[model samples]
Target: MSLAVAGEEHEESGGRLKAIIFGGLDGILTSFAIIAGAHGANLGPVPMLALGISNVLADALSMGAGEFLSSRSYNSYVLKEREREMWELKNHPEGEIAEMVQLFVARGMSRVDAEVVIERMAKYEEFFVDIMMKEELSLPVPSEEDTLESLKDGIAMFLAFALFGMLPLACYILAGMLAPSLDVTSLFSVACVATAISLFALGAFKARFHDKRYLYAGVETVLLGGACAAVSYFVGRAVSQFAGFEQLEFVIQYEQQPTVL
Candidate 1:
């Protein structure tokens, strides 16, 4: 049989997977933290639902927009650097070649051999600049489609955050709308369960993009999320107790509710 590849297959799609994993993790933790805090402060499900939904929407938009801007800025910077490299290569060929020679020698190549390779590579200007970018700057070659890539990244992050992050709040909203008579402790317990499941599942999903085993990743994520949850609950309880605050009104007002929390 033909030899199997000795290395893992390259995946351009890994960027999207990265965004989803990170965004989902963020969503799950934030939503759960909010739930835990609300529970500690004795906030009702209706308010929890409102707060959770708001967090998801606002954070998702922020993530998407931030990703787009960051990606675009990176692309622009790379292009500028490449242009500078090209200019130097055109005007100051000796310095660029000398720099390349030094890099090769630093990496354990003989001076003569490094000079030979650089001479051959320098004959092709585009290839020459690409080598300099990689060796000298540790950068990938910039692409014309960078804008589209940014849009994709932003959309991926937004969707991942919005969809996965909504899990904890989703239970509260559903329970409030459909089973209004459910006690607060019972509802919070259900929310905790949902949050735990969401964190574990998202971790498992992340393992598909990495070398980590699914079960290990899942458990690690749960522990991390549990830590965050504990902190959030403690903060809420401390804030309420220190401020001498009473329990919020339990009414689920539909009309004329205050717009701000």
Candidate 2:
């Protein structure tokens, strides 16, 4: 029986889930950091919205491109190793067969059965290559239509990042549009709550694929994100104070004397 067949479905789903979790986590954390820092610096809604939107788009694109390149690199390396294995199989059949027999023996198959199994597998070149890729190279065989699949994974990451990453700024932007009279502190408080809920939900979603309890995972993720935001907030606060930036704001009033013009 081919071991790959048994786990192929599981691996595919797991890979996609991982991409979503990774992208979501990154998006929420980064945007929250920017929001926290802006709040600490006592910035207005316009600046916060500008910073948050800029980070979201730039970071999502960078992450998607990075994922695509990384997947492509891994695919290339696997192809090269597969080529090497095929060459060795053709030029040194005895050595390759011995390695296969050893692998089976180590799995508790008797030497006689191991040799018999390898001999039968060798009769089919495709099956022999599959075994060598799995056992010798310790790599899953690449899917035949993987290029499009990789692209989809990258797009998934970008979309997840953009959606989840906007949470920290969502409340601020909405409040600015809906209620200009709202205090900065009130707006920031709402943003904090939204970010916390998002962090917890993402953690729980990720935990479904692992052995950890969902509540524990949720709390852990929230704590991590909170800690990062807290650090960023304090740093921004300290920098702003040291630079005396708070005193730099100016409100200009035009006097009726301007009619002299």
Candidate 3:
């Protein structure tokens, strides 16, 4: 690929990575919270599944939509600024050229050399404006295909949230469907371990992207997930007790119900 194509691809990859990290982190934490809280309250498998699935879908959509709108708004702002720069260049060519020369001088070029460079650049209006946009406004022009790229980012976020967020509830879901006679507590315990592992793996992936220490990043993410789970679980338990919810019996009765012919 040409340099420009390579750069665009790199930027696109970076955007996707950001969306994945954001969506995955949110998905894991939110799903884990729901599972931990429900388990602490001694809720039944049906109710836990309902909460987990609902949260995964609803929150994933919200995050994706939010990202799309935010990206569009940023692009709009950048375009507006570029328009302003274009206007200034048209109405004040001499001043703009002088500004470019001063910018080059500020960067350690001799004044005469700066003038010569600016004069040559000024021969090409588009190139001159680009240089001014970068040096004067400190704004790099975005890729022309950013709209499609933004859409890709949103889709990536939604997929990541849906897939990774299901980790904490996956074990329970599988057990309920595949082995109804299995111990509920054991299933939940397995789900907790899976969630921890997922969080660590996500952090390691993030660290790899940012060139950080993978082990430390993994540990940090795991600790964060554990802390969130602990808080949600304890708070749920406390509330259930205070309200006399009696969720344990309800769950037991639900599990014990006979299948109707």
Candidate 4:
């Protein structure tokens, strides 16, 4: 079956769902990695805190800007195409109606049904305009309100990531100070607990949007978070051992090179 039936509009809902999934998962995953690395290398609170703060701030601003630009560009393109559609309608109303008829006919409507629908729609220029915009173009133009909402979604993603991402680092920092004698393994255990809880909750939140079962979602998120954390931890350990440096300066400094992505 098709994703949507006729007279159904799921674009907005689907868009919102995707935003939540990607934003929450990315935040949990990326932050988990950083915290795992910091803890693995036995870096002091200073570098760990710096990395957490930088990752959150930089990612949030970047995501917000990216959303604003993409939404604005898409909106502009839709509006331009709309104007083009309007021009075509004005220049050749008959042709536009015929095309709409063909579109309806191709969708299982009989010729008579298609013509009747077209005739009824033509009576209201606005209705015809909407048909062409929605059905033919398949481009949903965002209103000013929609543009603001899109930006807000991006900001929400950033904040969500920041909050979840910092949990592991925060737990490590707090635990390390309170128990200075705690070993690296102990610290990692605590951080993992924090990571698991945060990722599970975020995954559940994401699942709510999809109307899916939470158990699977939670497990998926937890695994992804753990994976990211493990990779960073191993990489950090290798760097520290090979370089014979107690600090993570090399890894962080090397990351400063222009990201190829």
Per-residue CA lDDT of model 3 for 118-192, tens digit only, reads 999898887777778788888776667997778888889999998899877886687667877777688788888
Two-way lDDT contest, 2 vs 4, winner:
2
lDDT of 2: 0.85
Clashes of each: 0, 0, 0, 0
**What TM-score, computed on C-alpha atoms, does each candidate reach?**
0.86, 0.85, 0.82, 0.79
By TM-score, how accurate is candidate 1?
Answer: 0.86
Instruction: Summarize candidate 4's per-residue lDDT along 1-261 as a digit string, tens digits.
Output: 669656965536555656566666666667667767876777865786788768966775676567667877888888888888888888899999999999999999999999998989887876677679999889765577987777777776666656666677788778889999997778778878987988898788777767678989889888877777788989987877866664467777888889786
Q: List the residue pairs that clash in candidate 2.
A: none
Clashing pairs in 1: none
TM-score of 4: 0.79
Residue-pair clashes, model 1:
0
Candidate 3: misplaced stretches above 4 Å? Answer: 1-15, 245-261
Which regions of candidate 2 are displaced past 4 Å?
Answer: 1-15, 245-261
Ranking by TM-score: 1, 2, 3, 4
Q: Which lDDT tens digits does candidate 2 get at residues 127-171?
A: 798789998779867775787778888998998899999877886
lDDT of 1 by residue, 112-213 (tens): 999999999999999999889989998888677879988998999999999988888887667766887878887888888888888888888788778769
Candidate 1 vs 3: which has more TM-score: 1
